[model samples]
Target: MVGIVIVSHSSKIAEGVKEVALQMAKNHPVYTAGGTADGGIGTDPVRIQEAIEAANTGDGVVVLADLGSAVMSVGLAKEMIDPALAKSVKLANAPLVEGAIAATVEASMGSPLAKVLQTAHDARNMDKVE
Candidate 1:
């Protein structure tokens, strides 16, 4: 199964999203990369990289970042990885909470990395008003 990583400037938000996503991905690896090393309201590349490494289970990791810095942090984390491992990590351009849920459900179904990434991306088209 493909793993999942949620990155957010706020630690609580990241952890909370992970918790919710875990409901669908009970058997999959779900990780959170949040806050700075000093407990500030910011993203940490180190933490993001660690989360990516921990979540990876050979299939690959789908990263859902909350905001600007969190997104950049994930990118920086990817840059820090070895070329081979970097290829296994994808920075998903999907909404954090919704994307995490969608990805987790897909991953739980034993879907491949590309399928999981597609499901998360599709969440962006969902219409809440319907």
Candidate 2:
């Protein structure tokens, strides 16, 4: 099963997104990396790296981040982790909440990494109003 990581400047936001993703797929692994070590509103590369490692389960890990800095942190975190694990981690270019939910659903179905990533990216085209 693929894993998931949610990154946000606020710990609450990251945890909230994880909560929502879990509701859709309780059996899947979803970790969060949000805020600074001191509980401030900032992204931390080390925290993101730890979350990535924790979320991974030999399959792969998908990361959804809110804001640019969070995304950058994800990149830095990837560099800090093992090369093999870094290769298995993907960063989705989709809205954090929607992407996490869609990816979780796809991964819960035993979908491969590429499919899960595609599902997350596809969420960008969702027509919420229609």
Candidate 3:
């Protein structure tokens, strides 16, 4: 199973996305990283790294970020992780809610990391283009 990590500016947002993913992918591994759950800033590099490491047990891990800081924090965390694991990690451009759901569905279906990211991107684009 492919592991998933949800990063957001607000911890609640991250958790909400994770919850949706979990509902869609009951058997897959899902994790969240962010700040306080009460709408505070959730961009801690250490927390993001820990979440990624925890999610990346054996299967590859997919990271979904909400905003700029969420992505930056994941990038910083990647630098702190082992090189091999870092190579398997990917950042998804999908938005918080839809991206998490699409990623989770693709990952659960045993899609490659690249494809999962693409699915998330496609899902995001569908919303904009349709």
Off by over 4 Å in 2: none
Task: For candidate 1, write residues 1-130 as lDDT tens digits.
Answer: 6889999999999989988888766776899888988988899998998998988888999999998878778889999977798998988889999999999999889899999999999999989995
Off by over 4 Å in 3: 36-39, 128-130
lDDT of 2 by residue, 13-122 (tens): 99999898889999788999989999999999999999999989999999999999898899999999999999999999999999999999999999999999999999
Candidate 3: tens digits of C-alpha lDDT, residues 2-54: 78898887787888888878898887888988784454786888888999999
What total of clashing residue pairs does each candidate reach?
0, 0, 1
Give the winner by lDDT. Answer: 2
Q: What is the lDDT of residue 64 in candidate 2?
A: 96
Higher TM-score: candidate 1 or 2?
A: 2
lDDT scores for all predictions? 0.89, 0.94, 0.83
* TM-score: the better of candidates 2 and 3: 2
Report the Cα RMSD per candidate.
0.9, 0.7, 2.2
Candidate 2 Cα RMSD (Å) = 0.7
Q: Rank the candidates by lDDT, best first.
A: 2, 1, 3
Candidate 2, 104: how far from true, in Å?
Answer: 0.7
